[model samples]
Target: MSADSTRGAPCANCGDYAPFNVGRAGPRSGKMLCDDCADDSVAYIVDCLDCEWSYTCEEPRYNWYHAKIRVQQEGNTHETEQRVFENESHETVWRNE
Candidate 1:
């Protein structure tokens, strides 16, 4: 996602004036968060296996299999879901939920 200029407003989660991005998942959903706090709140990264496309989501009722099915049904093929962990900087490191 693109970073938005907060124009000196502090992050909603961490109170930092750093460059902020909109949080797409977890408790921070819809709120502006600093990069570190945004990364910390993500619970999963849904990716399309056929293309370099992905998004982060954190509905408590949603799981990897559910996300995969939803994505495929929407006409995207071969989607995968990877659980996110705290302090991880890259999606390359994955583990089963």
Candidate 2:
């Protein structure tokens, strides 16, 4: 698709602008956000177009405990980083960094 095609568009994962996004939370993914949010969310997959980055949100926006999230992407697969909510901050901790 042309870059202008998605101009002023929002990413499904990141909560900003880009081609599109995955969705919100739960069994069904949420709508798109933006490139920056996409990077923060930790996608099930990712594809960078131009200098901007686009990514896919996980199936469930949260986790078993119910907190925020952030995944990773390398090539076709996403480097899983399941941050769970816990500790004093009610944060989500993942296996990855």
lDDT of 2: 0.34
Tens-place lDDT digits, model 2, residues 12-91: 44444455323422122344444345335332534433223344445423331122233332322321221232222122
Which candidate wins on lDDT? Answer: 1
> Model 2 — TM-score against the truth?
0.22
Candidate 1: how large is its RMSD? 14.9
On TM-score, the leading prediction is 1
lDDT of each: 0.42, 0.34
Which residue window of length 10 is worst by lDDT in model 2? 82-91
lDDT of 1 by residue, 1-97 (tens): 8545554356666777644334432333335555555554224455544446555444333133454344334332222222233332323222223
Model 2: number of clashes? Answer: 29
Q: For model 1, which pairs clash?
A: none
RMSD of 2: 15.5
